[model samples]
Target chain A: MTSNAAGAGTISYEQAGVNYDLIDPLKVAAQRAAAATAGHLAGHGFTEVKASRGESAYVVDVGPFYLASIVECLGSKALVADEMGKLTGRSYYAGIAQDTIAMAVNDLITVGATPLVVQAYWAAGGSDWFGDAQRAQALVEGWKKACDTCGVAWGGGETPALAGIVEGGRIDLAASCTGIIQPKERLSVGDRLGAGDAIVLLASSGIHANGLSLARKLVERLPQGYMTPLADGSLYGEALLAPTVLYSPVTEALERAGVRPHYCANVTGHGWRKLLRHPAQLTYRIDALPRVPEVLRFIQQHAQQDDREAYSTLNMGAGFALFVDAADGQKCVDVARGLGIEAVVAGRVEAGPKQLLIEPLGIRFGDDDLQLR
Target chain B: MTSNAAGAGTISYEQAGVNYDLIDPLKVAAQRAAAATAGHLAGHGFTEVKASRGESAYVVDVGPFYLASIVECLGSKALVADEMGKLTGRSYYAGIAQDTIAMAVNDLITVGATPLVVQAYWAAGGSDWFGDAQRAQALVEGWKKACDTCGVAWGGGETPALAGIVEGGRIDLAASCTGIIQPKERLSVGDRLGAGDAIVLLASSGIHANGLSLARKLVERLPQGYMTPLADGSLYGEALLAPTVLYSPVTEALERAGVRPHYCANVTGHGWRKLLRHPAQLTYRIDALPRVPEVLRFIQQHAQQDDREAYSTLNMGAGFALFVDAADGQKCVDVARGLGIEAVVAGRVEAGPKQLLIEPLGIRFGDDDLQLR
Candidate 1:
C-alpha cells in the first residue's frame, strides 16, 4: 500500500524507514565508481559487460561465456516468519530460506544467465538463533532444496553471528549467485527489445520478497496483527510468508525452447514500476491484469491505497515479466505452463516515452518515477 | 583476549554473544547438505571440486579452468569505523571497505585462484545510514580502490535497508568473490602438503578481520574507550580499524615466481590455531614469532590474557601462513618482502601429531582445538 522506492510520490516507504530519496543517490554514486573499475577485468582476460551496470545482474565477458553475478538480501520477510511461527507452532524457516535464494537467483537470471552456484550469507544477532534445531534444520533443508531446484551448486557460505549489528534472536539472510551465459547470443539486457515486443507475465504466489517493510508496518495497525484473516480465510502473516516463486526453471524452459526474451524484469522491490526497468525509452501498455491475490487485495483495502498506488507499490499478481517478439508471447506462456507456472501475454511495448500504462487500472508511471542509474 | 572458537576452553568470544558450539553444528549440517547438491553443477558443464567443500573457498572444475568462490563478511569492523569516525572528524570507511574486500578476496586466493570479480552486500539498519555523503563516498572510493588493488572488476552489489533486522545506524558488510585457477596444477588444497615443508609467516598490519567481537567488547572496560592510546601512542580503536592486508599480491607474486606453496592459510577467526588448518595431521613447529602489533599487545595486556589465550585468539602478529619446501622458505619470505610485506621463515611442518607447537613460548595446541568441518 505504501509507494515503492521507484515511485514514491507519497512518504509511506520513507515512514517505513526506507527512504529512497537518501538511498538512491548512494546507489548512483556507487555505480559511477564501479564503472571506473571495469578496466581491471581485462588483466584477467575477462571484459566487463559495459551494458550490465545498472541491470539486475553484473555480467562479465569471460572468453567462451558470459558470467552474471548478483548479490541480494531478503528484506525483513523473516521477521514475519518468526512472528507467525510463534503463533502457529510451526517453523517457516524452510520457506524463508527458499525466499532468500529466490531473491538472488531470480535477479541473476534476469540477464539470461543460468545459475551455477549460490552462496548464502546468514548473519544472526546471536549464535543462539541456531540452537533451535527445527529452525536450523529447516533452513539447511530449504537452502539445499532451493539449490537443487535452481540447478545451482550449493557453493558454501558464511554464517557469522553479528552480535552488535543485528538484533537479538533475529537474522539477516542474503545470497550471492553466479550464473553463466553461453554462446554469447543468450545475453539479454533490452538492447534487442523492439517497440512491438510482447510483454509476458509470470504470476507471483503473493508478495514474494518486496514491500515487506510496508506490510509489516501495516500489520501493527490491525487489531489482530498477523492473526488477522483475509477474505479467503488465510492468516495475514501466513499469506505474506508464502515462499517466493522461483523463476529460474521458467527461464530455463524458455532457453530450451529457444524463445529468449529481449529483456527480463524481476518484479521485486519496485513493484509493477519495475516494468520499465530497462534503459529503453519504450512505453509498456498492459491491456489486461491478473487477478490480484486475496492477500494483496486485503493489504490494499486495509492500507487504503487506490488502484494506482497499489499497483505501483506491490506485485498485484505478476512477478516476472519478459519482453519478447509478439509472436513468441504465447510460446513463452506455454513454456511456463509446461513447468506448472501460470503465465500470460499481458501487454506490448510501443514507440513512445519511457513509461508504464496499466490500461485496466487507468494507472500511468513515467520515466522519472523509476531512476535506478 | 579470549579463546578462539576453534580452541575455546575460555568463554571470551562466547561472552561476546558468538557461541560457536551452538553455531558450528548448523554449519556442519549445511555443509553436508551442500555436499549433496554438488551434482547440480554437472548440468552446467561444471563439477564441484569435492575437496574444496570445507576449505576457505569453493572450487568448480570447468574443463579448461577452475573457478573458486568465497563469501565473507567484515564482521563488526565497520562498527569500529563508525565509532572512530564520530570520535575523530574523519571517515575511515575507505579502509573499512578495503577490509571488507580483503576478507573475501583473501579467502579466495587461499585456493590459488586469481580473483576475477567481487560483489558486495551492504545491509544497513536504515536508509539514513547513507545520508552521510562523506562516509558513503569513502566506502565507494575504498571499494573501487580495493578492486583496483586486487586487479578484479567491481561487479555490481546490493544495498538493502533492513530497519528491524539490522541495528539502527549500523551496517553488515559482506562480499562474494569469484576467481580463476588455470593449468589445474595451481590448485592447492593440502593435497600437496608434506612433512619438512617450511612455514612462512606474513606479518599482519594489525588484527585483520577476526576476534573483533571480543576486541569491541574490551573497549567497554577502558575508561577512554577507543580513544585509549597504546604503548606506541596510537589510538586503540584506530589501530584496531587499520585496514586488513590484501594477500592477493603475495599469492600472485609467488605464482609468477613459479614457487607454489603446498598449502596456504589465511590466519583468521581461529588465530594461530589456524596455522594447522590443513587436514594433513602434521605438527606445525614455530621456532620464531613475529613481533605482535602494539594494538594487539595492548589488548592482551589490558584484557589480562596470558600468551596462550592471546595467541589462540588474536592474530598475535602473522596474518597469513604458507607451507612450502625448505628450499623455498627464504624464497617465499623474499617474495613477500619484494611486495613490501614483511615475512619470515617462522616454522616448519613435521611428520608428527596433529598439533601446533610455539617453541619459544612453550605453547602447544592439540588437534581438538579447531573444528571447521
Candidate 2:
C-alpha cells in the first residue's frame, strides 16, 4: 500500500505546477511589513501578540481576552465540486462548504481559540452561477451545518459577482473567523514545545483540501474521470469530496479535560511536514504513521508520484497533529476516540535539527522544506 | 455639467453584463437560510442581533459588547491594476489594497463598530505572481497604509495560489474585519431612521471599486485604453483606480464627538440606490448632489450612458451616506469636515414610499430599483 514501492522518480510539487519556493519569500516579506502596523491596535486598547504572525492565525491581546483571527480560502477544491456536478448531476457544495469552514476554524483552533463567528466570501464568475436552486440550497445548508458543527454563528458574508477575474460558472470560496481564547492559559504558541513531547496524528477523511490542482490534473488522465472506480468501489471524485474532519471538538475536549497542547498544526498545504512547524529546532520523528486514505493512494498512483513527493504535498492520512507532554499522549488519543475520531500516538519530539522523519516510508523533510518563520 | 445632457439614453448596469436581478434572489435565499443558524450563538454566551443579518455586517451581542463582522472583496478592480500596469509600466496595487480594506471596514463602521483587526485573503492565479517585487511590495505597503488609516491591526491572512479558478497573472483580493461596539448604545440599526432625519453625503475620490467590470468594458472601446484622458487630464484608468475613502475614520470621528448616526451605508454596487437600503418606506430627497467626479463623467460620456443610468449604477460622486437627526445634521457634516472629508446636507428623509429623488438631476429610483430586504 506504500507509494514508495512504485519506484517512480521523485516528483516535486513544483513539477506539478505549484512552487511554494516562490511563495514563501513573498509571505515573509508581507509578515515583516504587517508587523510594522502593530502599533495601530494600541489606540483601540488592544496589543498585538507578536509571535502569532506567520502562524496558523493572528492573536491579539484585548483587555480581558485574546482574539485569534484567520482568513483562508477553499483553494481549487470548489472546481472539483464543479466538475463532479457536471458529471454526476449531484451538487458537492455541501462538502465544499465544509472544506471552506474547516480551512478557517481549523486554523483558529490551532491557537487554542474557540471560533465565535465565521464570515464567508463567495465570489462568483457571474450572477447566473447561482441560478441552480439545488446547488445554492446545498451551499447554504452546508455552510450552516459546518457552523453548527464548530459551535459558531453563521455571520453574514459578501457574495460578489466578479464577472471577469473569476472563471465563469465557478466560485472562489474564502472565510474569515474571529475566535476567543479566554484566561489565556490555553494558548498554544510552541513556547512550551520541548523534547519528549508526544506527537499525535489524527486521521484525515481523504485528501482534505490541499494538492487539489494536481488531483484534478490526475483526473484528466483518468479514462472515466470522476466515475473511475477505486478498489473500494467508490467514484474517484466522491472519495475526494469527503467532508473534512472538524478538529475543533478535539481541542474543546482537551480544554474541558484540563490538558494543554504545547503546539498544534493543521496538516494542510505542507502535509505532514507541518509537524515540524514549531520555531524551536526540534525533530519530529514519526515511528508509526496513520494509514493513508485510499483517495490519496489513488492520486499518487494516477499522478505517478513517489512517497517522498506525495507525503510532502498531500495530507496522506493525517489531517491534524498535536504535540503534548509524553504522558498526556494516551489521554489525547482517548479524548479523540470519545468524539469518534481516530487518533494515535505516532511519534515524539526530539532535540535535533528541525525536520520531519517518516521512518516507515523512509521519507525525510529537511528544515529548508518549511520556512514560514 | 450633468451627463443627462448627452442624450445618450439609459445604459443600465445589466447592459454592461452585471445583473443584480439574478444575484439578489440567491442572496435573499442565503439570508433566510442563515437566519436559521442564529440560535447557535446562544451556546457561546452570545446572542445574535437579528437586525444585523441582512445589513452591511452581522452583529453579535456578547455580554456588554456587540461585535460586528464583515467579509468583502475588491471585485475586478485588481484587473484594472493589471491592465494599468501593462500600459503604464507602474503597479497600482496600493490603490487596490485600499479599495479592498475599505470594502470591509467601511461596512463594519455602518453598524457603529470600531475596527480592531482586519484579515486579508489574497488568492493569486499562480504562485509566481508574487515574484514581481514591485507588485508585492506595493500590495504590502498599501495594505499596511490602509490599516494605519483605519486604526486597526494588520491581522494575518492567507495567500493561496489558486492556479485555475482565478485568472492567471492577476490576484483576487478580499478582506474581513472584526470590530467592537462597547456600551451598545452606539448601535445604528435603522430603528432611529425617522422621517425628519437629514441625509448627509460624503464625497468620493472616484469610482471606488464598484462597477469596474463595466468600466473595463468601456476601456475596450477607447482608442488609448488606460491612457485615455478626461477633462482633469489624468488617464481614465488612473482616475478610476483612485483609492477608496476609508469611512471608518468618519464614524470614529463622529463617535469621538458623541454624535450618533441613525444609519450609514457604503455607496457601492447599487450606487445611490443604496441610500434606500433601510427597511422603511421613506423617501430620500436629495436637494443637492455632490459634483460628479471626472472619472465617472468620462465613463458616462464614453459609454453613452444617461444620468439616471450612471447615478443608479455607479457612485457618481457620493461615496458614503449617513442619516442623522435633522437637528444634528450640521454636526455630523462638521465632524467629517474636521477629518478633511467634504460632507453636505444633501437631502431629508420623508415619510413616503421607498424611493430616492435627486432634484438637481431630475432622476428618481423607485422601490423596484433596489429589492434587497
Candidate 3:
C-alpha cells in the first residue's frame, strides 16, 4: 500500500488543465442566451421554468407535469478504466457505463424529477473501437443494467465514429435524460429553501465522474500507477472506477415517505461547495462531515491538498445533500438508510452571507468559488 | 474555379475510416438490449412504442401525447469548419451550430414528432477552446436562431472540456431532442405504406453532416485544400459547411394541411438509400432525380465514384424524402414550396423485391446496402 508520509507537491484542478475560470464564463453566457429562447417553448404548449435555467437540470412546465432534462458526460474516467484494463486484464467498461448513466440521472433527480428515459451519446475515435467484442458487450450490458436500476428506459442514442476530433482508441460517453415531476409540487429549484433547513448528507461509493482530470494526473506521479494499492488494499484505479451510487432510489423513497426536501444538490464538479448551490443568500455551517473514503484520502495525501482544497474539488464521502425542515432531517436520513445508503445530519442552513463552513475541518468556501451563473 | 476533370484516386467511406460493417452490428446488439428494457418504462406510466425501436427516433406512449426523443451529433463537419476558419479568417461556427441542431431535429420529424426542446452537448478538448470569443458567440447565436427557426426551446446543456479524450484544438457537437406527437394519428413509423405511394424529394443545401469524413478527405487531395473554388465559384469548404435544413416546419405544415405521409426519411448517414429505412419490404422506383449540388458533383468527379456509390453514401441533392399517397403528393410539394423549400414527386413505391431503382442514374440499391436494424 502507498504511504501517506511520502509527500508530493500540492496540485489543483487548474494544474490538471481544467480551469473553471476559463470554462464557467462561457457557461454563464450560454445560460443568458438560453433564457431568451424560452418563448419558443410556448408554441408547443409547454413553458420553460425560468428559475431552472442555472439549476442542475432544465425544467419545463407541461400542463399536467413539469419535465426536467439534463445532459451529462462521464469525463476522462474511461481513460483511467482503459489504463487499468490494460494492467488488470479485466474490463471496467461495465462500471464505466454505470458512471455515465449515474452522472445524468443523479443530476436529474436534483431538480426533483424522476428519470423516465435516457439517451446515450457514444462517440468513438474510429469504428474499430467497437471491434473489441468484450468491451462492447460489457458496455451494452452495463447500460441496460443502469437503466433498470434507475427505472428509465434505454432510449436510442448516437454512436458516431469521429476519427479526427476524438483521440484514437478512446470513446467519449455522454447521456441525456428526460424526467417528470408530477403534481408540480415536487419541483425543487431552491425557491422554498429557508435558513433553518437541515442538511442531510448521503455517502458516496467513491469518486464520481467529476474531477477525474485531476485524479488521472495523480496516477502519473505514483510509481505503481493504477496498480498502486490504497489503505484499504484496493488498487487505486479499481477504487476510482467503483460504480457511482444511483441516488434516484433515495429521492424516490423520500417522496414516498411523504417528505419533500426544500432543496437537493448533487455534490458534483465543485464538491462540498455545492451545498451553497441555491441562489438563496444563506450560510451552510456543517458541524459534522462524513468519513472520507480511503481512495479520496489517498488522493488528498498524494496530491498534498489542504482540507479546503480537497473538499471543494472532490466529493470526499458525501455523494448528495438534501435540505429539509429542521425536524425532517432525521427522516430523510432514515429513508436513505432504508435504501442502504449511509446518511447523516451533517449541517444546517442559517441566515448569513452566502458561504459554506466546515467546522470540523476548519474550512470555509466563499460564494465566489463556484460562479455557475 | 477548379474544373471537375482533374481526377484523383477513388475514395470510399470505409477508406475514410467510417465502416458500417464494423459499426452497425453493435447498434443491432444495443437495440436488442434496449428492447428488453422497455418494460422499465411501465413504472413511469409510459409505454414504449415498440415499432419505433429501429426508426430514426424513439417514441413513448405518454397517454395524451406520444413523446419522441432522438440523440444526434455533427460528425466531422465541425472539423471542416475549424480548418476553413483557419484558411478563410471567418467563423463558420454559426452554420456549424445549425448543422448540429438540424441533424437532430430533421430526424425527430421523420417520426412525425414536433420538436419541443433541444439540449446541446458541446465537448471541447480543453477550456481554452472557448477562449476565441468570436467563435463562441457565433455558436451561441446560431443555436438560439436555429431553435427559433424550429420553434423549440433552447434547454440547458453540458459543455465539458475533455482534456485527454478529445483532441486539442477540436470540439465535438451533439444534441438530444424531446418532441411531442399529439393526436396519436400523426405518428408515422412506416406501418401505412404499401405500394403506389409518391416519394417527394426535398432539396439539400449541400453536404449536411453525413459523408463529411469522405468529403474532408477530398480536401486533402486538392492543391487549394478548403480554398479550392468549385464551378459555382463557392469555395469547397464553404459549400460543405452550409447549414442543414430544418425539416420540422415542413412536417408541421403537412400535419396542418391534413396530409400525413405514409412515411418520412431523413436523408442522412445512409444517404438516398434511407428510402428503405422502413422495415417493410418494398421497391422504390424513381423516374426523376433532383439536381446534384455543385459541391457534391465536384466530390464525385474528384473521388471518381460511380452514381451508385455517391447516392448511397451522400445526400447528393435530396436532403429528405416523404412517402405519401399518390393523390396528396402535389399537396406535400406545394406545402414545402410555400416554405421556400424545393420539392418534387420523384418516384413511386412498387410491389416488388426490396430495392431502389433510380431510372435517371441507372443506380440500384438492394436491402443489403443499409441494415440499420
Candidate 4:
C-alpha cells in the first residue's frame, strides 16, 4: 500500500490489502507470513495473466447483439468422491463443467436470455499434474460444448490455483451469467394473475442437485435398501446424481404456442418454495398434485423428516413449475408433454397472502413463521 | 437457489442460503452459528442491464488498449491488525479490489488491451452488517470509479457468504476482471531492441498488494520509521496501504505512437524477476534506474536485507516496466517523463535466453525453472 513518487489520484493495491496507514510493525509481519508456499510462479512463457483475474475484468466480443445470460453449476455430484472416500471411487471431474453449463443455460431459458460465455473454477488438494490438467482442459471443453448446445458461444473462463485455502480435494464450480431481454418482453413479479389460473408441473429426474448433503447423510445412516433399492435391494448413488433437467424445449413450445405465463421459476433448491420469492400476496391451491417419486419417499421415511421439511428441500418429482391461466394451462401442459416432459395440470391460483395449501398432502406451507422467517 | 411454477425463473433469497439444501442436518445449528454477525445480505434494487449480452460480453469496440493485473494480498495484514488490538477495523479489505483489477488489466496492457469490467468477491465472515455492507459498497464504488476513469464499464460482480469456513472477522476477496483488444492492434512482445533498449520503471508504492504476510512480521520487529508514516506520524500502517501507481497514460502514449515494445509487465511481487515471462529470448539490461524509495530502504535497513532481496520481494517504486527499442528508448522515456513519471533509458535487448538482469540493482529474474510440473 506504500506509494512512491506519489501525488493525488495515485492509489495502489496495498491499501486494498487491508493495510492502513496505522503505525504497527507486527501487522506488516503478519501480512508477509504466507510467502513461503511450495509452488513456483508459473513460468513466463508469453505473459501468463492469472486465469482468475482474466475472467473478472476481460470482456470479449465474439459477435454482435447484447448477448445473453451465462448459466453455470458447481457439479455437486463431483463432491461425492471429494467428501466421501476418494480411493474406492472413479475420478471424473469433467462432467461438472457440463452440469455447471446446464444449470446456467436452464436459468437463461426462463429469462428468454441467450447465453454467450461460460466460466468456472477448479480447486484440488494435491495437484495431480496429469489428472488436474486433464480435468482443467476437459472442463473448459465441456462448458464450451454446453454453451453450443444452447445455441451460443463460449467466450472464456478461469482456472485459479489456491493451494492451501481449499484442502480436501475440492473444486467448486459456480457461474455468473449475463443476458438481455426486449424491454416489452421482460417478465416482472407483479404481472396480472387471476383466480382461475392453472398450475403446470414438469416431471423431475429424481432429486436433482440440491439437498444432497442431507440425503447422503440420511442414506448413509439408513438400511441397505432404504434409499436406492436394487434387485436384491441396495443403494443408488446414480439416483441421487439425477442429471439436471433442462427445459429449453419447453421455452420453444411456449413461445410457439404464444403462451405467456403469469409466473415461472426453475424448481431447484427448496422446490416450490422458490416461487415465494416473487413477493406477491397470492394463494396457491394444489387440488391435484404431481405424484411423488420413490427417492424422496425413501429420504423422508428413512430420515423420519416431516412433509414440510421435505417439500422445502427436495424437488418432489417436479423439475419445474409454471402458473398460467386455466384456459391456456391445458395447452401449455400439452405442449410440454409433446416435448417429452410429463407435464400435467396440477393446481390453481387464488387470493391470499402468499400461502400454499395442499389439501391432499395435508400440508399447509408458507404461513407458518417457522417456515417463512 | 430455487425455482417456481411459471417457467420464468425466480427464487426467494432465503432459498439460496448455503445450508438451505440440506448441506447440514444441523442447519439450525449452522444458521445459529452464522447468525450474530454484520455483513448480512443487503437488499438493494439490482442494476438494470443497459446493453445486449453478446456484444456486451466484450465492451471494447476498437483496436488499441492497456491492462492491469490483480491478486488478493493473501498475506495476513488483517491478522497483524488483530494482533495490534483493532479487530473491528474496516481494515484493508476494500483495497484488494484495486489490486485485483490492476492485476487483470496490467496484463492486458502488456500485450495492449483495454479493460471492460472490474469484478471481485469476498468470502463472508462474521456477519458484520455495517462493516461488511460499507466495505462492499465502497469496493464496488471504487471499482466503478476506476473503470469510469479508464473509459471502461463496470459489470456487476459476485459476493459469496462463507461463515464457518473462514476465520472470525476475516474475508477473502477473490477478484477477476475482463478486458478487450484487437488482434492487429495488440502490442506484440517481439519488437526490435538492439544492445541499447530502455527499461523504464513506473515507480511502485510499498508492497502494493503482495508479500504482506512476510512484510508485517519483519516490519513489526523493526525499530521505527521502518514503514510509511501515517497522517499522525504512525510509521507502520500507512506504507503498507500506499496504493500502486497506475501505468495507464504511459502505455496509452506508446500505443498512440505505435511504439510496440519487446516486453512489458506490471511490476508486482518478485519485481524485475517476473519480466522473463515475456516472449522473445533476449537479455533485458536495465541501467540508470530510479532511486529506491524510502519504503524499500526502510525494509532493507531494518530487516538487514540486500538490494536484490528488497526488489525481489517489493516493487521498490516501479509498479510497471517496459522494454522498448533503443531507437524509441529516449522517446519512450521522454513520453513517460512528460506524463509526470520518471523514466530512464534503463535497459538493452541482447541475443540470449529471455531474461532480466538489473546490474545496478544487483538482481536477476526470469520465468525459466518454475515450469508447470
Score each candidate by Cα lDDT: 0.88, 0.86, 0.89, 0.49
The interface root-mean-square deviation of each model, in the order shown, is 0.8, 1.2, 0.9, 16.7
Per-residue lDDT for B331-353 in model 4, tens only? 88778878777776766777776
Order of quality (TM-score): 3, 1, 2, 4
10 residues in a row with least lDDT, candidate 2 chain A: A1-10
Tell me, by DockQ, which candidate is best.
1
lDDT (10s digit) by residue, model 1, range A1-64: 3454334334354566678878888898898888888998877777988889889999988787
Candidate 2 lDDT by residue in tens digits, A243-357:
8899998998898887899899999987877877877898889998888899999888877778887888899889999999999999999999999999999999999988888
- Residue A310 in model 1: shift from native, Å? 1.5
Q: What is the lDDT of residue B289 in candidate 2?
A: 79
Per-candidate TM-score, chain A = 0.96, 0.95, 0.96, 0.70
lDDT of 3 by residue, A1-373 (tens): 1322233587787787787777777777788888888998877777888889888899889777888887888989999899988998899999999999999999999989988889988999989888888898899999999998888888889888998899999999999898889868999998889989999999999998877887888887888988999988999999999989999989988988988888899999889988878888899999988989899999899888889889999999999999999999999888988989999999999999999999998988888978777
Best by lDDT: 3
* Candidate No. with top TM-score: 3
Ten residues in sequence with the least summed lDDT for candidate 1 chain A: A2-11
Q: What's the CA RMSD of model 2 in angstroms?
A: 3.4
Off by over 4 Å in 3: A1-7, B1-8
Q: TM-scores across all candidates?
A: 0.95, 0.94, 0.96, 0.60
Report residue B80 deviation for candidate 4 (angstroms).
5.9
Docking class of 2: medium
What's every prediction's RMSD, in angstroms?
3.2, 3.4, 3.1, 16.6
